[model samples]
Each structure stands twice: as C-alpha cells, then as structure tokens.
Target: MRIDRTALTDLAQGAAFLGSGGGGDPYYSLLLGQAELARVESFELVPLDSLGDDALVVPCGWIGAPTVSVEKLPSGLEALAGLKRLERELGRPIDAVLPIEIGGGNGLAPLVSAARLGVPVVDADGMGRAFPESQMAIFNIRGLSACPSVLTAACGALTVIETDDNLTHERIARGLSVALGGIAHMVEYPLTGREAKDHAIGGSVSAAIAIGAAVRRAREGGDDPFAALYAALRDTSLYPYAGELFDGKIVDLERETQGGFSVGRVVIEGFGGSGRMELVFQNENLIARRDGDVVAMVPDLITVMDRETADSITTERLKYGQRVKIVGAAAPAMLREARALALVGPGAFGFTDAYRPIEALNGWDQG
Candidate 1:
C-alpha cells in the first residue's frame, strides 16, 4: 500500500495517540512527511509477509528528549546517512525499513527515509508503543541483538555501535544522545525479514493510519471523535481495548530533560470536586493513578489529549491548566507476555508494582 499526502494528518493524529504522551511532537515529523510526499507523491509500505527471508529490514527512529525537538530542527539527513552506513557495514542493500517505534513522530520518520532511499517501509515496528529506553523495544525483549546499530546526528557525525549486550547499547546510545546535543536518529535492531516477521508487531503502521482516519472522519461528521478513536483501536489487532481514563484540567506538571530523556509527572484535577489523576512519565507516560488508586501503568498506552478537539498532548508539549482527557488502552498481546513484561513492565522503569492490563484495571472487559 501507499501512504499519500491526504492521509498524513490522520497518521499523525493516530501516531500521537499511540505515543502515549511521548514520541516527540507530531507536528515536526508530519511537516517532514508532507515535504517528502510533495517530492515523491506517495510512500511505499509493503506488508511484513511480503519480505523475503534473507531481506535486510532495519528499524529506525529518533532517540533522546522530546524537548529538544522543539528547539533543534532535524536536517532530515540523519536517517539517510545512517541507513547508507548500515548498508556499507552489512555489504547488502536495504530491502526495506520500518520504524523502531510507531508512536508519535517516530512512526513517520521511516516513510521519509523510504521515500528518499527507494525502499519500502514494512507495516510493522519493534515497539507497539513508544518506550524510553532501547532495551524496552520488543527486539530486545525477544532476544534480538541491538548491535551493529548506527547513530547519526544532525551535524553530520555518525557512530556505529556493536556490543553483546542490549542494556549497554542503550547506555552508550543514551550517552551519545546527551553528548550530541540531546537528540539523534538511530537505526538499530538490524533484522532479517524472517526475524522481523517473527518478532515485530505486525500491522501497526496501518493500525495508526486507521485510528487517525477514524477520528478525522468522525470529527468532520460532527460525531464524537473519541468514540471513533476507541472504535478504531478496538478494530486493530494490536491495540484491542481503549477508553478514557480521566478527564480534567492540568493542575500541576514537572518535567526536565535528564540523562537524555524527558522525565516528568503531571497532575490532572477532575472537573467539579472530583479527585485528581497523576501521571509519571519518562518520555512516554508510564504510570497513572486516580485519587491515589493505581489506574494504569507502563506497556499499556496512556495519553493526555485535548478534550474538545481530541488532539494528543505529548509530554514535552504539556502545560499547566490545559483542559485534557487522559486515555488508556491495552497494549498488544505480544507486549503483555511474561517475556516482554520483564523488559518493558513497570519494574523495567524501577517501579515495584506488577504489570496489569489496562482493560482489567479499569474493568473494561466486564461491561
């Protein structure tokens, strides 16, 4: 399938929701995707099964604090340079590319690369939702090596990483992002088509597009956009359950770019005399609580969105006193497995709580 300019906004909107209040601002990447479409007409997206067993499939995205993207503009050269270098190292041309994470602006970065590099982007990704660290990617959770990765900066510098350990790769990459002025593009988890088909979350790219388009169409028809969004997510195999977790005004927010990440928390006061919902985030919203009761946690998707327009308000873009609704959705089943949870669950972020499904926590399934 081909992604055209007409579907760009929907993709951005859906991707923003999938980001769960992280993934950087969708505006910058949407603009970049638009510009690329203007030159190439449409970006090619091949199905995961279409790839041959030996085909080289690389996953790529930006890493570091989302705050940095607001001030530092990407030159659009990072991914291209990094992809070329990867090809040289592998001694094989890239058969296709996919987003390392399909949340926020990272989802669209691969389309820009595919358009420029003449390779199709697979309809899959390593992270079903955005994660703060490299080790959180399903690639690492599935025992895939993160080595032979390429990190590229906007200033034209490039570094190749090779290590037997994924956690070490994350530390080195995080350090480099800090040293490189807080953000850079990364092409990691070099996978053969067979490995990608076996591990990567399938149909996520199309799922994001569908969610966005559903919201847009609903808004245009004067229907409830959130209803459309929830319905769209339920229709997808990856994110099967969706609902609003809380509705309120942003009463408090604390955020900082620390250790190459945007770390912060937000407090939302419910309308009238209702209690508050608090969300702690590391790039992506990790854990959420309502009236001190644990309502949602990591691996599950949590998003703060504009109440009226249903626009996603990412972590870096959040502000005090913004009227918003907090939403939650169950993560893909693959990410909820025992193996995946050990790496991406609350404990992965140093939380002591055991992982709980968003649907179960909220009793969404009972009704």
Candidate 2:
C-alpha cells in the first residue's frame, strides 16, 4: 500500500488515538510527514508477509516526553543517521522499516526514515498501542533482544547500545535522551522478516488510518465523530472493543516531565453534577477511576480527547477546564496474556489490582 498526503493526515489522527494519551503528539509529525510528501508523492507500506525470510527490518521512533518532542524538533537526519549506523554494524542494507509502535508521532516517524533510506515500511509494529518504556513492547514480552540498537539525536550525536538486558537498554536510552536534550530518535529491536510476521502486531498501520478516516468523514458528514471512532476501532481486529468511559471537564491537572517520562493525572467532573473520573499516567494514561472506583486500568487503552472535536489530549497537553471524553479500548489479545500482563498490566505500574478486561469491567460483554 502507498501512503499519500490524505492517508498521512488520517494516520496522524488515528495514531494519536491509539497513543492512549501517550507516544507524544502527532501534530508535528503530521507536518513533518506533509513536508516529506512535497518531495515524494507517497510512502511505500509493504506487508510483513511480502518480505523474504531473512529480510532485515528495523523498527524506529522518537523517544522522550511528548511535551519535549513537541518543542525539541529533530534535524530530519536523525532516523537516517540511526538506520545507517545500524546497517554499518549489521553489515547489510535494510530491507524495510517499521514503526516501533503504531501510536502518535512514533507511527509516522518511520515514514520519514523510510523515505530517506529508500526502504519500504512494514505494515506492523512491536506495540499495538503506545507504552512508556521500551521493555514494554511485545518484542521484549516475546523474548526479543533490544541490543545493538542505535540512538541518534538532533545534535548529530550517535550511540550504539549492546546490552543483554532490554530493561538496561531502556535505561541507557532514557539517559541518552535526557542528556541529548529531552528527545531523540531510536531504531531498535531489529527484526528478521520471519520474526516480524510472528510477533509484531499486524495491520495496525492500516487500522489507524482507517480509524482516522472514519472520524474525519463523520465530521465532514455532520455525524458524531466519537461514535464513528468507536465503530471504526471495533471494526478492526487489532482493537476489538472500544467505548466512551466518561464525558467531563478537566477540573484539575498535575503533570511533570521526570525521568524521561511525562507523568501526571487529571481529574474530570461530568456535566451538571455528574460523578467525576480521574486518570493517572506515566507518558500514557495508565488507569481511570470513576468516583474513586476503578473502571479501567493499564494494558487496556485509556485516552482523553476533546469532547466535541474527538482530538486526543495527551498527558503533556492536558489542561484544567478542558472539556474532554475519556475513551477506553481493549488491548490486543497478545498483550492480555499472562506473561504480557506481567510486563504491562496495572500491577506492572505498581498497582495492586489484578488484571481485568475493560469489557468485563464495563459490562460491555453483556451487549
């Protein structure tokens, strides 16, 4: 498939939703992708199954707080620099590139790199939705090595990491991001085509585009965008269930960019004396509570979006008094498995609550 300007715009919108209130905002990435579109008409998106068994596929994205990513821009050479360095280390040309996660700016990031490197992007990713740490990716959960990964900054500094521990790789990468000025681009979890097909979340790229297009078309057609978004998400195999969790105004907010992550929470009160909902985050929305009762938690996706426009409001972008709708979706089945839960469930973030499906919690299963 080819990604044209329209598709790119849809992708930006959809990726922001998939970001689950993290993965950084897609606004700048949309502009960057548009800029690239001016030079080239479209970006090539190849399916994972199309690659040869031994094809070298690299997953790439920007790392750091979404707040900083909005301010600290890339030099356009970061992805290419990282990919080239990785090629040098691997002693071969890359067959394709893919988004490390199909969420927010990270989803659009690899397009720039793929365009520059003249490689096609695989229609899949490690994380179906955004997460705070690299070790949380499905690749790591599935026992893939993240080492020999390359990190590049806008300042032309490059570092190659080689650690047996994926957690250590994330730690070193996070430190490098802060030292380099808050944000940087990374190409990690290099995969063979077979590995990508086996473990990566397939069709998420096209799914995001479809979800974005649905909302856009709904808005253009005088229909409800949020309804359209939920329908679109449910229509996709990647995100099976989705619904509005709450509709309210942000009454309070507390956010801080610390330890290479944007951590905070927002309190939202429903209209006309309705109950309140609270969301906590570490780069992405981790949990949601309604009137102090847990309604949804991590590993499931929770996103705060403009109530009227349906645009996602990331953690960094949250503001008091903003009217927003909290939306929740069931994560991909692969992420809900026992082992995967140990890596990304509510307990993984230090919550004592056991894992529960959003559908079950919200009683969506009855309908």
Candidate 3:
C-alpha cells in the first residue's frame, strides 16, 4: 500500500496514541515524513508475508530521553547513515526497513529510511508499542541478538555494536545516546523474512493508519473521537481491547531526564473530587494507579492524551495543568504470553503484581 500525505498524517496521530506516553512526540517525525513526501511521491508499505525467505529486514528507531527529543534537531541523515552502514556490514543490499517499535515518533522513523534507501517499509515492528529498553523489544524477547547494529547520531557519528547479550547492547546504545546529546537512531535485530514473519508484530503500520483515520473522520463528522478510537482499536487484530482509563486535570508532575531516560511520575486529579491517579514512568509509562489502587501496568499501554482533541501527549510533553484523558489498551496477544511478559510485565519494572488484562482490571466488556 502507498502511504500518501494524508495517510501519513493519520499515521502520526495513531502512532502517538500507541506510544503509551513515551516514544517522543510523533509531531517531529511527522514533520520529517512530510518533508520527505515532498521529494518522494509516497512511501510504500508492504505486508510482512510479502517478503522472501532470504530478505534482509532491518528494524530502526531513535533511543534516549523523550525530553531531549523535544529539543534536539535531527540533521535528517541519522537513519540514512545507519541503514547504509548496516547494508555494508551485512554484505548485501537491504530489502526492507521497519520501526523497532511502533510508538510516537519512532513508529515513523523507517519511512524516512525507506524513502532514502528506495526500499519498502514493512508493515510490522519489533515492539508492538514503544518500550524504554531495547531488550524489551519482541525481537530480543524472542531471543534474537541485537548485534552488528548501527547507532547514528545527528552530528555525523556512527557506531556499530556487536554483542551476544541484548541487554548489553541496550546499555551501550543508551550510553551512546546520552553521549550524543540524549538521542540517537538505532538499526538493530536485523532479521530474515522468516524471522520477521514468525516474530514481528504484523499489520501494525496499517493499524496505526486506520486508528488515525477513524479519529479524523469522527472529528470531521462531529462524532465523539474517543468512541471512534475505541472502535478502531477493537477492530484491529493487534490491540483488541481498549478503554478510557481516567479523565482529569494534571495537578502534580515530577518529571526529569535522568540516566538517559525520561524518568518520573505524574499525578492527575479527578474532577469533582473523584480521587486522583498517579503514574510512574521510565521513558514510557510503566504503571498507573487510581486512588492508590493498581489499575494498569507495563505490557499494557497507558497513554495520556488531550481531553478534547484526543491527540496523544508523549511523556516529555506532559504538563502540570493540562486537561487530559488516560487511555489503556491491551498489548498485542504475543506480548501477553508468559515468555514475553517476563521481560515486559510489571515484575520487569519491579512491581510485584502479576500481569492482568486491561479489560479484566477496568471491568470493560470485551464483547
């Protein structure tokens, strides 16, 4: 499928929601994509099954503090440089590129690479939603190596990482991102078509676009955008369950860029003394509590969005006085499995509570 300008705009909106309050704002990537669209008519998105068995699939995106992404400007060559280097290292022409995770701005990172490299963007991603650490990616969770990966900075520096351990790869990449001024594009977990088909989150790109389009249409027709959003999510095979978690005014926030990530917590005061909700984070939102009761946690997406517009407010963009709605969606089925949860579940973030479905916890009918 060809993604034209309008679909690209829809994609940004959808991807922003998927970020779960991290992944940096898709606004910047949307601008970059629009600029790229001016030179290339449209970007091509191919389904995962379309690739040949031997096709080389590379997943790429930016990593670092979301706060820094708001301030740093890209030189527009990060993905291009990293992708070109990966092709050289592997001794073959790259067949396709996909986002390492499809959340916030990172979701669209591959489109720029696709336009520059003249390759199609695969409609799949390593992580169904954005995660703070590289090892949390489904690729790594599936026991894949993140080696021979390229980390490119906006200032003309490129480093290739080769490690047997995915955790070490994340550490090196995180350190490099901080050194390069808090953010860098990464090309990692290069996969064969078979690997991608077996492990990657399929149809996510189209899912994001569909979500954005649904919201856009609702707003245009004077319908409730949130309703449209819920319907869109339920319609997708990836995120089957969705609901509005909370609606309130942000009253207290303790956010700061720390240890190469946006680490902090936020408090949202409910209207008319309905109690308050507190959320903890490390780049992406990790957990949510309503009146001190655990309502949602990692592996389940928790996003903060503008109450009226329903546009996502990335972690760096969350402010103390904004009226916003908290949205929760179940992670893709694959991420909820036992093996996948060990890396992305609440325990992974030090929370003792076990993984629970968003629908079960919220009392929303999945029917």
lDDT of each: 0.93, 0.92, 0.93
Report the error of model 2 at residue 232, Å: 0.4
Write one digit per residue (lDDT tens) for candidate 3, span 1-367: 9999999999999999998988889988999899999999999999999999999999999999989988998888999999999999999999999999999899997998888999999999988899999999998889888988999999999999999999999999999999999999999999999999999999999999999999999999999999999999999999988988899999999988888999999999999989899999999998999999888888999999899999999999988899999999989999999999999999998889988888889987545
What's the count of clashing pairs in each model shown? 0, 0, 0
Question: Cα lDDT for residue 172, model 2?
Answer: 99
lDDT of 1 at 269: 98
lDDT of 2 by residue, 1-367 (tens): 9999999999999999999998889988889899999999899998878988899999989889888987887898899999999999999999999999998889888898899999999899888999999999999999999978999999999999999999999999999999999999999999999889999999999999999999999999999999999999999998888999999999999999899989988999999979999999999999999999888998999999999999988788999999999999999999999999999999989999998999999998788
Model 2 C-alpha lDDT versus the unseen true structure: 0.92
Clashing pairs in 2: none
Off by over 4 Å in 3: none
| TM-score for each of the candidates | 0.99, 0.99, 0.99
Q: Kindly report which residue stretches of model 1 are placed more than 4 angstroms away from their true locations once superposed.
A: none
Clashing residue pairs in candidate 3 (N, C-alpha, C atoms within 3 angstroms): none
Q: For each candidate in turn, give its C-alpha RMSD to the true structure in angstroms.
A: 0.7, 0.7, 0.8
135-190: candidate 1 lDDT, tens digit per residue:
88999999999979999999998999999999999999999999999999999999
